[model samples]
Target chain A: MLTKRIIPCLDIKDNRVVKGIKFLGLRDAGDPVEVARIYEEQLADELVFLDITASYENRKTLVNLVEEIAQNIFMPFTVGGGIRDSNDIRELLNAGADKVSINTQAVKCPDLITESSRKFGSQCIVVAIDAKKENDGWQVYINGGRTPVDLNAVEWAKKANELGAGEILLTSMDYDGTKDGYDLELTKNVVEAVSIPVIASGGAGKLEHFYDCFSQTGASACLAASLFHYQEYTIKQVKDFLKGKGVSVRQ
Target chain B: MIAIIDYGMGNIHSVQKALEHFGAKTVVTNNPKDIETSDKAILPGVGAFDDAMSELKKQKLIAALNKHIRQKKTFLGICLGMQLLLQNSEEANKSDGLGILEGEVRRFLDRKGFAVPHMGWNQLKIKNKNCPLLKDTPDNSYVYFCHSYYPQPKDKNIIAAVTDYGVDFTSILWQDNIYGVQFHPEKSQQTGLKILENFVNLC
Candidate 1:
């Protein structure tokens, strides 16, 4: 059976791991490689490194960091943030990243999704959608949730799947960093909207939150940052809880 | 030394890195000469079946790989590399594969809730505990997988292990000198590393 994935997202800024509440007021976490090794030890199903580095010039550091992490960690990991074109995707994959997540570039040129997927295979292309609940539905946000777009969340997810994206990293900007819980409704809508696997992201506070997202939304995976970063709950603890709850988790 | 055949299909770095982690010397090459000279070779790929077959042909790796396997040298295929070992695939257009294994690659049917790609960690039920590739690997151990199409071997005796999603599919296959895994052992963490190590330690 394909078990529900438990991912630990390491938001990178200036090559250092950081976590922010609602994508603001970032706090230092630790070194990327070191934190990654710790997660690997904790039996993390996968690791997501979101390079929040601001300057395009510093992007080379991310590639170097990815190579270093790949050398040390044997588990599958994803590199995202500031990935603009096919070249970026190729560079990351060559550097040993199993997948590359694209945000703003995907919206700016939706063709990137199709082109990259065609070139590198859809399994390696992940479209990260940052969404916030609006009027009657949710609107998509890009540029690390700083800019709002006219696209609807569910529609964008379906469009991304149609555009050849293998997976959707759906993060709720409203629930992000709140430590409340996942946006079950938004996740469920998107999961139902697309046939590709949907990774539910943002607002993972407790063990039950992880269970809730899996049970309520049928998400293929759940990604958390601060909850695991601060050592409030270990991945083993979460997986154990889920296992006890009859959730099919990789133990 | 192990040669990882790279036909420009997908990433081969992780495969090389994982093997090297087990202290196995590896070279990533598209040249047939490298593959021919290596004692063991790994065909690691990701992408559509036809594209991979075309790339392998363009690189002239088909004859070299078949020669390597015919010579009774150990050969392993990962993901699309595994699919390419079969007779043909039903992806895109009906296309021929390497024909080394008597099987056809088919896409997963659109079940009610099962995803097509069948991504993430899944347990393996080892059928052949004597297979060297699964030497120390325990039954029901989890491994990483990401693919929409899976190979259905005509010879069931060649299947060494199987995994379930919506159906029980051949996750690992072994014959005399050729082995193929639908999962990415390099990216499957510890159990994956163990399998890679087993391959590396094969004499």
Candidate 2:
């Protein structure tokens, strides 16, 4: 049986971690490699590093950071944020990233998904969808969730899978930062829409939230940022809690 | 020194980095001479079987790999690299593999609940505890996997370990001098690292 994954997402800006990590006995919390090492120590299943740098010139820094992190950490990690073309994906993968997530580019030019997936393998292409509930349907958002697209979240997920994306990282804009819980309906819809793995993201406040998303939505993985960044719950604690709940988690 | 084969298919860097972490000197190369000269070699790959086979042929590594194995030198294959060890794969249009091992790569059936690709961490049911590659790797230890196709060996005795998704598939393959793992040991955290360490220490 494949175990559910617990991923700790780290936002990167200009080669450094954006969100403050409050891990104890750490020299530099903003360092992506250091923070990733801490999560690796906790036995986190995987890590996602989203490069949120605004400028285009900082892309080189992101590549350098990925190389440094990959050299040090042994666990699988995904790098996303400004992935535009196949070259970007190639550079990152050559730097030792296991997967690369694409967002706005995927929506702006969906052919990128097809081309990159074919050039590289579909297993390394992840389509990150930032969605917000609109009326009864969830609408896809791009440009870091500041702009809305006409694509439906569930439909987009299916299209991404069709476009050869290996996985779907579905994040709910409404539930993010609130820590209320995961967007179960949206996640469930996307999970059902695609045959590939669905990683439920955003609004992971408590241990139950992770369980709820996995148990209720049939999500293959759950990703949290502030919940783990604040040291509220370690990854081991979350996995242990899920284990007690009869959820098959990687221990 | 270990030779990490770079056939321009998948992420060979991660494999090299993991081996280096265990203090194992590694050289990433596509040249047949490098692979033939090395005491041990690792074939780490991702992507479709047809493409990988073509790339390996384009780089002229198939014969070198066979020579290395025929010499009784240790060899390990990871992910698609593992699949390429078999005789053929059902991926794409059903292409031929290296034929080093008597097996066929089959895609995971579309079961009702089970997802395709069988991605994520899965536990290993170790059948041969005596296998040196599994040293310090406990039974039911979790390892990272990402693939739609898995190898079904004709000789069950060669299977050292198995992992269950919708079906029990061979996750670890071992014979006299050749070894293969369907999982990405470099990305499987401690258990994966332990396996890599054992492979590195295997003389």
Candidate 3:
């Protein structure tokens, strides 16, 4: 039986894990390896590390961080945020990333998705879409949800699937940092549109929010950052809550 | 010592890291002598089948591996590495496998409502509970999987476990000193680590 996955995402900036990731397990906010171990202890099925650092020099640090975290933990993890081409994907996978999520570059040149998936298996390529509700439908957002692309969320997801993307990471721009809840309508649209696994990101204020996204939409995995980072809710708590609701989770 | 065969294919770093976590001495090399000398060997692979087989041939590790397996040496194969143990694969046009196991690697059909790559965590239904790799693990344990194709063995007795995507496909295959898992044990979290630990201890 395939179980729904709970993923905790860590955003790395300047070669350090950003956000106040203060925890009993972590020595500091910048310790990606320590933070990753704690999440694994909490039984996170998978992890996603976003390298928000844009400089070439800092990329070396991010690569090193990925290697350290991969060494420390045994679960699959994805690296995203500023991946440009197939070569970039190869470098990170060599460093031990299970998958690479591409957003801006994918929208700029859709061929990047095809090429990356072709070179590396589709299982290693994930296309992330940061979407915001526009006049009538959801429009894709890029550059950390600052710039809006003239693409529909559902259409873009469908196109990504056609291009051989293994999975779709759909983050709702409106729900991000709001801590309200996920855009179920948007998530449902993308999930229904794509044949691959869809990871619902952003929002996730409460435990029920994770359950709501899983039960309401066809998302195979749900991702949260601040909630888990702040220690408000552990991955175990969320999995137990979902398990109570009769949702299949790795318990 | 354990040898991780480096066939110029996928990254074997994570596999090495996982084995090292268990305090096992490991080496990543294409040299056949190293593999033959080690108590255990792991064939870690990713990407296309033809390319991987070509690289193994180029390095002249295929014949060495065949001899090592014939000697009943402890061997483990992971993901594409596991698939390569079969007779042939449908990937990369058409390619012949090592023929160590009598089977063919077939692609997954695009069934309605089922993903092709079969990415994410799924439960393993143990077929042969006596298999050493299933030791210390539950009957239906969740393991990570990422592949568009799976192995179809000619001899079903070698299959230790199976997972259902659209069909009941083989997840783990074992016979004597040889073992293979379709999923990435290095990426399957604690359950994965336990599997690796079991393999390491088999020596």
Candidate 4:
């Protein structure tokens, strides 16, 4: 059975793990490696490190940091941000990063997805589509939720899957940092539309929210940052709750 | 000395780093001279079977590998690297393998809605009760898995461990000095690193 995964996302800027409210107003979390170690000890199913600025930066420190994590922690984790070409993807994976996520670069040159997937294999490629609701329709956002993309959310997911993206990380910008819950409608909409695994991100406030998102939306996994960062809930506690709710967590 | 064969397949650096992490003197090499002189050889591959074979043949590393394997040297294969040790793969078409181990690779047909590439952590069912590779690893412990095809060994003596995805499938195979893991030991965290350490300390 496909176990429902819980991943703690570390947003790296310059090299440190930081989080912001609604994609703005940054706050320091802690050492990236220490935080990662905590999550691993808590039995986190996986970890996601996004160089929120990987695409914009001249050079990325996330790859080095990810290598540090890979040296100690052994569970599979995906590194997103600034994966522009096959070489970048190959570098990250070769560095012990299990998977690499692509956003703006993938949209601008869709060939990145197909080429990376073809060269390295699809399971190693992830297409993370950042979206927000606008006038009853989801609009895709790129460049760390700073740029608006022309492709439709569902359509882009289909294209990515067709291009050999094994997983889709759909994030709701509107609900992000709100602590209300996920944009169920949007998450469900995209999950139903794609055969590939969908990870619902943004606006995960409480344990029930995870249950609600997984039960109602049928997402393969739920990803959160703020909650885990602030110690709002330990992953084990949340997984225990979800397991009680009959969700298959990697126990 | 561990020579990680770099055939332009997947990430060889990480594999080397992991080996070096365990204090193994490792060299990432494609040259036959380097491999022949190394104490052990590790084949790390990612991508289609046919292309990996083509790359090995194109670079003439297969003959070097055959010579080394015939000398009873330690060889470790990872992911597609592991699958390539078998007879052939059903990924795209029938492709020849290194044949260092007795097995054939086949796509994992869908079972209970399991995706094609069985990604993420899954438990391993060890067959050889005294398998040294699984020393500290727990029974049914969740090891990272990312692949579509599993090795079907012709000889049960080589079966080190099995993992259940659809039905029971081969997760790890060890024959004489040749060892192959479908899961990345370098990526499996503690358990994975332990396997690598054991391989390094192999007598």
List of chain A TM-scores, every candidate: 0.95, 0.99, 0.97, 0.92
DockQ of candidate 1 relative to the true structure? 0.74
User: Whose lDDT is higher: candidate 3's or candidate 4's?
Assistant: 3
User: CA shift at A150, candidate 2, in angstroms?
Assistant: 1.1
User: What does DockQ give for each predicted structure?
Assistant: 0.74, 0.74, 0.69, 0.46
Quantify all predictions' global Cα lDDT against the true fold.
Answer: 0.89, 0.91, 0.88, 0.82
Q: Write the per-residue lDDT of candidate 3 for residues A97-158, one digit (tens) a residue.
A: 88999999999999998887877788888999999889889999888788987899999999
Q: lDDT tens string, model 4, A1-251?
A: 45788988988877777773222122324567667777778888789988865644534466677777776675778888777778788778876787888888889999888888877788888899999887868999988899997778988998898888888999999999998998899988887777677889999998899999988998878999989877788899899999999987777
Candidate 3 Cα outliers beyond 4 Å, as residue runs: none
lDDT of 4 by residue, B39-93 (tens): 7999988787878888998999988998888899988888888888888777745
Comparison by lDDT, 1 against 4, better one: 1
Question: In model 4 chain B, which range of ten residues has the least summed lDDT?
Answer: B110-119
Which segments of model 1 are wrong by more than 4 Å? A20-29, B92-95
Identify the CAPRI category of the predicted complex in candidate 3: medium
| Candidate 4 DockQ vs. native | 0.46
Q: Could you tell me the lDDT of residue A249 within candidate 1? A: 93
What is candidate 2's lDDT per residue for A71-130, written digit by digit as tens? 889888999988888889988898889899999999999999999887777888999999
Docking quality category of candidate 1 according to DockQ thresholds: medium
lDDT of 3 by residue, B113-200 (tens): 5766788889899999999999999988889998989999999999999998879999999989989999999988888999999998
The lowest-lDDT stretch of 10 consecutive residues in candidate 4 chain A is A20-29
Top-scoring candidate (lDDT)? 2
